[model samples]
Target chain A: MQRPQELRNLFRLPLPRSFQLGSFPLRSHLRWILIRIVIKTFCGLTNTSIQSLERNKVASRFEVFALRLPPRIQPFDLYEAILKTNFRFKQNDIVIVSSKFVSISEGAVVQIDKIRVSHKAKVTAKKFQMDEKLTELVLREADQVYGGIPGFLLCKKNGMLCPNAGIDKSNIPRGYAVLYPHLPFESADKLRLNFINNNRLKLFVVISDSRLMPGRLGTTGIAIAVSGFKPVIDHRGEQDLFGNILRVTMRAVADGLASVGVALMGEGRESTPVVVVRGFEVNEEDRKMNWQDLAIDPLEDIYIRSFKSK
Target chain B: MQRPQELRNLFRLPLPRSFQLGSFPLRSHLRWILIRIVIKTFCGLTNTSIQSLERNKVASRFEVFALRLPPRIQPFDLYEAILKTNFRFKQNDIVIVSSKFVSISEGAVVQIDKIRVSHKAKVTAKKFQMDEKLTELVLREADQVYGGIPGFLLCKKNGMLCPNAGIDKSNIPRGYAVLYPHLPFESADKLRLNFINNNRLKLFVVISDSRLMPGRLGTTGIAIAVSGFKPVIDHRGEQDLFGNILRVTMRAVADGLASVGVALMGEGRESTPVVVVRGFEVNEEDRKMNWQDLAIDPLEDIYIRSFKSK
Candidate 1:
């Protein structure tokens, strides 16, 4: 399939190699206007919905729809499953798929009996009163292990703090555990490109996982992987209502979107594995986002940092 | 104004003093059926929409709409502002108002100039590089002071963990800082009753505040207080998709709904302070919920507990 980004490259307008520092915004603004006009003309020529294109510019409101799918025992085509739902994919729409769903689609499931019982895993499992096989899987999947409670380990996986490294034994069949989607960022990027190249529709994709927050009961949503947008909207140097410049008010857009999706996609037999969010527009960047965009270093985290001093 | 809960009490049927343990669900189910029939007949007798009442029984989907209001300079009638939105409040609809809005409406604001600083507050201010007056306010408001960073104190206020004891110097006039609602749970309960008594509509009210999670950027929504429903839906003893009994899978419904509201109510200059959510229904309870319903002891928290041993 031809890359959809080729269309943007075809419309590239070169600027002067050097410009005044203060003129950066004006230059970018001029470039944005030119791209908008070109894209508008292209949409008109191609009979695409101009309203959808315009809405992406200043859309504030959002409508989230849950797409329920049957439970799968084996890997299946996620793209075809989405199409089977008959939900029309629109430009700039956000598609949030559960990490468990993604794992199932990618055949990331493993039988508990198949895991090797490493000595460290066995010791850790004994201490935490967890299954040794699950402990091994968690250790293998985690980037860094912090600590554990009974039957669960709190760890940083893919720069996100989650218990059990986002592994799932609850939703799948007995004795089979599901690991997080192998290379989640790449998987999301590939899925995003499939939509873009096949239908000429650029949309965002988030691999979401439910997480328990500190000092709070129940789980909220966190984005394990994201594609087609900057995960965080940095609001540095922007004035608050009191006119003081905000230095640390970055909006974790991806995680927020994930939470919205998780609210609809329950962790039970409701069977909703996919959620389609429309009218939630963000700056669709071509550059692929990685873990750094949404997560802070554990040392820099207030909760983690405070624990050290104590 | 009459308390809205009296209507529920009027229809309370006496239950058998003792029952089989397995028959509890059945008894509740029968009671629920009876209540539904009575409410439906009552709606038929009155001019209420029976469809709205029926929809509450099985509402799995939700549509959140943001209601923008002008910035207030002083305390005003929150009920009237909601009425001014011209939004219809239906039975079981969830209303989420920002804590800042509630604080303003209740005049939970203080001028920074008029605060008396104690020795502890002065030491804290100097240590954290915070204003002495603001530190004094946070110290007073906090239930437990954990620690601090450069400019913010991490404290537990009303069973919620937050920085600066949930004090706000933003989104209001300069030289004034807004505190958390003096009695958040009571405020939410009172507002819910206003809707029920005035409009004859029983709706859920959530006092929401944006919270920054550890190791993540941007703030998601948390319900500081909720009325008309249990904040957490305990899935204990319920089977997961794999038929395994869930032990620690309670759904934080109020917080999830609040996050949906905060997504629409942007923290910037959007001016959206009220969000009306429809089609998301939970069991309506007459019991008033305190902070204990949603939060655990800090010592019991996994994140905090892990730190103690280290």
Candidate 2:
């Protein structure tokens, strides 16, 4: 169990500063009391009254735009391509790039003809009813093969459960496969820095990939790496609507944001490799963070506990 | 294994109608050629060309607005309160209502003082370190209790793996708990019909709730029930970016939409129980669909396969 201080730090909320109410000067106390009364008046109003107070306030909205980039985009040219779409980047805007696009930019594509398949690769390929070269790639890329049905291998790649170790043949040239970016976290950080320097704006960058959930058809977006904000919002000490203190509610903000991006970046020929998510209010701090913040330790994970390792 | 015909039906995509390309009538052949040329031209364009072609095209966007409603609202008045927010409803808009709001409207609040506890409830409560009456309610609401750590219960409610069977204490009046709606699908359907009748418009209705994922901190939205659209988009035979046919990719459209809504609906004090999600293109079919379409069968689920049922 995490200590309260550590939990607060992990969730990136500021620790409350201690202050002595009794030590306040006489004038300060009067000001404080007046402020308290105003706040109390605001809180005492009914729900509708409070809403009508801010009826003109625009609600937070998000626009998911798919940038139609060329199929074989180099990593160095990705930023220019995104800007060419003429979508203006604002402070705190979330820019999501598909990992496949990042891989291609990083020159991570491998032509199948170059891979010399070994005996183990051939045997595993035959057993799994997959192509020999693809099986070899899956084995090399995966930390551990969890065994999968024919045509797919469930493997742990960078602490994530992925099909074929995220070695995808899609969106790449024929006879080649696109590996996940060599360093997704570094990739996101570099992009964030570049965007900040070039546009002089604060923003968040997320490298996203698709993954299937257990028993759900189709894939939802998962955040492979993120920069410019804390990934999780811990609501442990917050009170629920019933005034009951909530103990175990934390929002996976990164994953939820990635899902929003991926829903617009469809898997088909929509050709949207990048999406711009705006209007989400995120902490503006651009501190260094790791994708591990979103990862569940294998031991503590309920799904992993239930998993019978093949 | 599902037959190709049945798979197509389950995914709800239209099967290709058999026609001989060589035997097309003269006018039909001309039309086909024109369409082929247009599509080829669209596909062949570079990023800049495509952007310039549709320079004024707005990207798919969503706005999540919370409707502030008085507590203890009757179910019939919920729709009127939502409309009173003054947000315009357009064709194919998705209106998401928090299930807690739905439950409160349905008069599903249980006063803890009025409940009589059984011996089983009392012992189980002590074992789980929870309130005895709440445990009794959890026991009654749950289909099967899977045991839990202190202060939580792992149970199945409406075939969903929910904590405490979706019984919530938050956001309700004092000394009362809110139960999950008796018939979520019916609730969604009724809302959809009411919206259509009242506004003379087309739209999707989703009743959403928050739930924790197996090793993740915080909660994301899950769709309890949805009407006016297909919950899942199956991409079984669709070709991936690599030109290889995809076998198992089904997009959980409803859940993804729910997550988008829930991300905007903060758990604490953001009393916006209703959200209006605009601008995602959903298949606008008013056919009756069950929430079961989005459920994963336990036997077939990878995560469930590993679960050691207590």
Candidate 3:
């Protein structure tokens, strides 16, 4: 559970520093009282609580823009590419980078010819009708290989559920595949730190990847790694509008922002591997998001647990 | 399969109609050839294919803004409230409305005192440690119930997986719960048509609701109903950057845009019920999204299959 003060930070309002009615001059106090009356009348007319007025004031400030980057054939300085775009970074702005972009920058490419298919890989490949070399890579990269479809291996990688252990054969040359970035959290942190130290701007970084949700037809964005802010905002202790204590209502801020980024960075070859989101506020900190904090035990997951009970 | 011509619409370029090289005047021919050379040179320098150049040109045009509307304490005219906001609806603008807003307008609130609990509701409620009346509502609304946790019932409602049959208890007065809107697809389609017939503008409408993904701690937005556009964009026949045909890469454009809308409309007391997305290029039509088109068989779902395989 988050501290009460921290939870209140989500709807922190802008008000006067002091409310000492006696200390204020008569003229100023009369003006303040008039302002409150106006606010109350407005809320009554709109059927809005004062809380919503403050929250919506904050909500309206968010701005998101996708940055077009030069396509990467090999590893290069990511910071330089961003700087070249002439997009000025502001304090607390979030930078969402496609995981594929991070992988390419880290030179995490694996040529198919170099991979030696093992006997296990060959058998699994045959069962799923997949390429033996690619299956070998999936086997090596995945923490646990659950099962597979014809072209995709259902696997768990770095505490996240994904297909083919987050390997990609698209947007790269033939006969080569790009793995998820090496030490993604470290990469995100390093990038965040680079901006802070070199540019003197505190910025958040998120490495995003696209995933197909169960029973859904298309892919949505998920956060692979995050730096400078908590990925999930815990709302367990908060009260709903009905005044019921919310027991399980955390906001997956990172994943939601990732989806926004991915929408702008089209799945096809758009070359927009980066997106900048401004004015959506979250507590900035020198922290890297841990997989353990974001993921739950598979057995306890509702979707998985339902199947187990069946 | 979608027609190949329709698939090509995703990345339709802004090239001139005439491609007959021999029929062009020499000056015009030289200009055309020069343009191609410049494009080729730019592509060569940036490692971007000409396809991406055209695609990014389209990607850069999206703009999203949330509209603050008066809170509805009772059933009211939705279209009237939208017109009250004084937002000029443009062609192809997508209007995302929170499902709660629609539910309220439909008088979908269930007063806890007015509900009668059944024997089965009592037994099921005791098992899940939930309110019997709410349990009865869930049982009544759900198409299929698949077990549950202490406070929530895992159920499929309207071909969509949700907790508690998508019944919401927050943001309303005490002792009352709001059910999912009646005929959500019809509501969305009617809203879309209302804008067209009255305002003389083509508009897309999506009724969005928030849901927690399996193993994820917080909620992301999902589209319950969509009008005026295909909710999913199929990319099956499109070529990847490597020139390999994409087999299964559908883009959940509606859901993605819904998530974007939810981010701006804060879950708590923020009274932003509608969000307008402008300049997002999707073919608009007089069609409502069907569940059969969005959902797949439960047996084929990867997450469930993995658990069953285990």
**Each model's C-alpha lDDT?**
0.76, 0.70, 0.75
Clashes of 1: 0
Superposed model 1: Cα runs more than 4 Å off: A1-60, B1-60
* Model 2 lDDT on a 0 to 1 scale: 0.70
TM-score of 2: 0.76
**How accurately is candidate 3 docked according to DockQ?**
0.20
Q: DockQ for each candidate?
A: 0.17, 0.18, 0.20
lDDT of 1 at A148: 79
If you assessed candidate 3 against the hidden native complex, which CAPRI class would it receive? incorrect
Q: Candidate 2, residues A193-227: lDDT per residue as tens digits?
A: 88888989777888888776654555777788888
- Native contact recovery (fnat) for each candidate is 0.40, 0.43, 0.45
TM-score of each: 0.80, 0.76, 0.79
Q: What fraction of native interface contacts is shared by candidate 2? A: 0.43
Identify the superior model by DockQ, candidate 1 or candidate 3: 3
Residue-level lDDT for A50 in candidate 3? 38
Please, what are the lDDT tens digits per residue for candidate 3 over residues A172-276? Answer: 888889998878899888898889889999899988998777777788888888899888777777776556666677788888888888777876667789988
| Model 3 TM-score, 2 decimals | 0.79
